[model samples]
Target: MSRILLVYTGGTIGMIKNPETGALTAFNFDELLSNIPELRLLEHKISTVSFEEPVDSSDMDISDYIKLAELIEVHFEDYDGFVVLHGSDTMSYTASAISFMFENLKKPIIFTGSQLPIGDLRTDAKENLITSIQLAGLKERGKTVIREVGLYFEYKLYRANRTTKINAEHFEAFESSNFPPIAESGVNLKINHEKLIKPNLRKKMLVHKSLNDDIMVLKLFPGLSQQTLSYLFKMPHIKGVILETFGSGNAKTDDWFVSLLESLIERGVYIVNVTQCVGGAVHMGKYATSERLKRLGVISGGDMTTEAAVAKMMYLLDKNLGPKVFKTIFETSLRGEMN
Candidate 1:
């Protein structure tokens, strides 16, 4: 039987509604089996490890991210696969960071959570949690079917770095518009082998815990004053910027805007151009507006979600790859984050 580890870092999936107060509160995860007895029927040996104090997704920081990565690193060899219970709000960010932190990953790291508390009558937690565990343990011909970080919700399993939280009030809270799901959980679990990341079982997993969070996301919009934009970019601490541009990465071609970005690039602030639209890539030079950004050494985040861009920026900034190499590496798909 496959040995699976359910790492509970706290989220809506672990909460139960109090009968008296009607407030949702975290329950002891040790009684997970009691809460979800269907796990007993699965043929996998499941174990769990939870944070000492549950962290709200909104408050998850770099330290918490490192802690999660270290936990998986410590027990990576002991388990066949891992299922992470994370908050739906920042699950994509955390999962995408984990994907970039691990190298040569040969087993599944499936993240899943629910929109409602686990004890609620109409909770989506049970199916998400149960199926995530099953997917974690799924293998064929003595090899794990999934060999990279994935986020499973509703019925689809998407590559972690390709996902974004699109809905705040729906059961289907996450979507991957840039890429298709690697698997789908229907009557029979369907694995899309064509999309799965090939694994190298001969190599040991390499964990990268060093991350630099000194980055800013500057989303461009009309009526954004030049003085405000200039001041934000001039902040000495920001090492990188994710420039959220209009459709197809178009930005204002005003001399002031272009000059400010050019100055930042010269001053060693790595800038990446990503589209604000949900389902399109950043074709930097396709338009006259973005052509100047391309000329000024701005990297293109082709079809990459902003969550992935942020995580990748933090991960790469720590390496001190300088402006040239950093731009090249950021534009490259090291973890299949960009096309």
Candidate 2:
């Protein structure tokens, strides 16, 4: 039987109604099997580990990212695959961060969560949890099937970094617009073999624990304040910025805005230009408005989701690459985050 590790970092999936007050509370992960009796029917050997204190997804930060990476590194060889139960709110960001944290990853790291508390009537937690475990344990010819980070939600499995949480109330909260689902569930689970990532089998898994959170996002809007932009850009502590631009990475052509970005680039601040739209790529030079940004050394984020761009920047920022080197690397596809 395949061995799967269930890492519970807390989410609606782990919550149950308190008998005394009927309020939702995190269930004991130690009693996981008892709480979800259907898990007893699975043939895989499932074991769980949980945080001492459950953290709301809004409170999740880089410290939690390091902790989760360390946990996986410690038991990398003991388990065939891992299933992480995370809050749906920030699940995409966390999953994207984890994807960039590891090198030569050859085992499944399936992140799953639910919209409603597990104890609620018509809760979607049970299916999500059960299917995630099954996917984690899937193998062929003595090798794991999925060799990358994936987010499993509803009936679809998407590349973790490519995903974005598009809805707050719907059970189908996440969407991967630039890429297709690598796998899907129907009457029978199906794997899209052609879409799977193939890692070099020769390299051993390496986990990157160092991540810099000294970056910020500057989203452009109609009549965005130049005063506010100047104030934020003037901050010495800021190392990188994700510039969310208009369709196909277009932006205002005002001299002050252009000068501000140019000055920031000259001062060694890495700026990445990503499209504000969900489905398309940032073709920086395709439009005149974005041509200036391309010439100003703003890295084109291509088809990468904002969550992935943010996580990728954090991971790369810690490496301390030079501006030119960082721009080149960021534009290239690392972990299939871009085309």
Candidate 2 global lDDT: 0.92
Please give the lDDT score at residue 214 for candidate 2: 91
**Model 1: per-residue lDDT, tens digit, 1-339?**
899999999889989999999998997788989988999999999999998998988889889899999999999989999999999999999999999999889889999999999999999999999899999999899878899999999999999999999999999999999899999999999999998898677888789999999889988999989989888987998888999999999999999989999889888888998989999899988989999999999999999999999999989998968778888888899888888
Q: Write the per-residue lDDT of candidate 2 for residues 245-329, one digit (tens) a residue.
A: 9999999999999999999988888999998998999998898999999899899999999899999999999897988899899
RMSD of each: 0.8, 0.9
TM-score of each: 0.98, 0.98
CA-lDDT, candidates in order: 0.92, 0.92
- TM-score for model 2? 0.98
Clashing pairs in 2: none
